[model samples]
Target: MAVQWVLVCHGLVTLLVVVSFLCGQWPIFQGTFIERIHFFLTSGAYDYFLRFVGAVFGSKCSNAVLSVEYYCCDRPNPILQIFYLGILSMTYYFIVKSSFAYIPGYYLSGIHRYTSLLAVAVGILLFLLTSFSDPGTINSANVSQYLSAYPYDNIIYAEKECSTCKIQKPARSKHCSICDRCVARFDHHCGWMNNCIGERNTRYFMAFLLWHFLLCLYGTVAIGLVLAGRLKELRVVYILTVYYGIENSFLGLAPHVAQWLLGSYNTLILIAVFLAIVGMLLAGFFGYHAKLCLTNTTTNETFKWQEYMSWQRKLNEAKASAAALRASISGMSSDRKPLLSKWRAFFQRSPLQDGQIVQNNVYDKGFVHNVVEVIYPLSSRPSFTRPKLKPT
Candidate 1:
């Protein structure tokens, strides 16, 4: 019940954030009560943004200056509202993850299992779709129109000279404030992205987006449920005055969230999709990370470790500390050496490897090495038989 409660809450928060983001991007509610409210708050500086979004959406909104033809729903054919609404993510993460989690203990850890991975993946995909897909490119409004409308349009690509960057600029592409370059698949000026979106970690970066988004959406859903339950426990709206005995009162902890996002299938399905997709994306990302760790391939050195420095660093680190101690005392620093050089040395000199010396000065005597195969190394070692005396 506790776990179930948690999942429910997460779904709510997930739905709201996605809805709000989509609303800003697509303004589906134009001419509706909510749309009027948005128009009022965003009409001044945000007029152009509002209009471009409006044009893409075929809704009525004012115009602005300087624009780029990004943020189009350039999905294959008719892009459904469900995609932007994040309904896809909700289903996968919630149903799939909850099912997987209920199956006894995590085979490894609470989160390292399939359930968690699935949850994370859904989050990643939605983020990619939103972050990678350009509003301008996908929108039909010509670049000139977008340019005239978007006041800050000059910064779109910053007069970039790159072949890979979008012609009208990708959704999150920015003229790297520092790199003096346009990041192809930029998310943010995140203190990290390793090296601009080249061949290696574009996938991993996408994975990162998926997992992080999942984490957020999952939290939203979990919290939303809790808030909802609280709300139902207390009647709301018109009943508020009667229930509270106040003329016009607010501030009951029943859960405003439930009122905002509940009792609609389109919404319910959207939330479910967000959860489900997030779960799968997470699973895939972590599995990839695990494989990379086991195989010793890093994000930077994805396909190959071309740099001599990386190879040297890896070789130096690979030698067990025992080898380090031996080398340090013997005045032989293994730094900057090739991997094979040290690999051959370990088998030749180390008693631990040959089965003669079990544990000694080479490594701290108490150290535990070859623990599983310790018996083999000891028994196969030369026997300590009392030598037969020679009869001279």
Candidate 2:
């Protein structure tokens, strides 16, 4: 079970690292854990024993206060942040879902797409919340007054680390221990996303989420449609369906979200079709991004590699990129390093390997819902075949 150990270790480490980065409470988790070892060094029980022993030696008593922000992302009210984390805990439930056969056109087996669809709804929420127009539209006088003070439409800076750095919060800044650098507009750094979700790529991230959720949902329905079509030939109940049922299948669709937006019959069908198509496209996107989020897919992955090509290699490709780059230079490189050297390094890493499969795999089993699933490359890949879900 070396493979299992490796997977478990990777999962624990990655999850802890992510949780640490997101929660900023490594000390707490670390300390609270392995308490027996820490007792002699930091625990009160050990201190009492030491003081008792030192009573004969006349050890002096001292008092100090230390406050720790544990598990709550070091925000002003971390307890609230934990509560929010509970709400935002993403599940691959949509993807793990069973098919409902009673419905004529219902879909199944494309959890990856359902995840994309779910992410889209989330992206819209995040984008909209992030979308206020500087509040300058309402007051020109305040805007003009502020122009001399700050003088930029959208300006964000990384506040330098210092004793007072805690108070001098910078715009879109997060202290990343893994990178050991502060990222701007710090969203979560996913092992899946492989990079920090900062100011530069938050939009893409949200978009990825939106696309991923829809993709999973679409594939779910589409797979169901195909499965339904095949099952019709046999005319068997497909016993699993009797329990999973048609009503619960509605969970795959953002029933509330769709209903709120689409009121017309023709419009609803159109919306449904559009959602379905988007979901299909999302399936493709998730197939791509599952490698991405779990492994280090980047913007360069788009337009350059089908998989996770390192930014360095992508940079090198860019230097030689007369043929590789887009019509317009988006200047999307994560590293501002020289492109030629980056290209050389990329070639060195993989001489014949064309695309990448960057980042590590995390196979944590406790809870995974609506997770975008990828088919491991195998001897055979038949598209129309009904698939089996991988064990958690």
Tens digit per residue, CA lDDT, model 2, 221-255:
55445444544444433432454353324464345
**Best candidate (score: lDDT):** 1
Clashes of each: 71, 38
Show model 1 residue runs off by greater than 4 Å: 1-17, 27-101, 104-174, 178-201, 206-392
User: What is the overall TM-score of model 1 with all chains considered together?
Assistant: 0.23
- What is the lDDT of every predicted structure here? 0.41, 0.39
Evaluate model 2: give its lDDT: 0.39
- Report the CA-based lDDT of candidate 1 relative to the real structure: 0.41
The TM-scores of all predictions, comma-separated, are 0.23, 0.24
RMSD of each: 26.9, 27.4
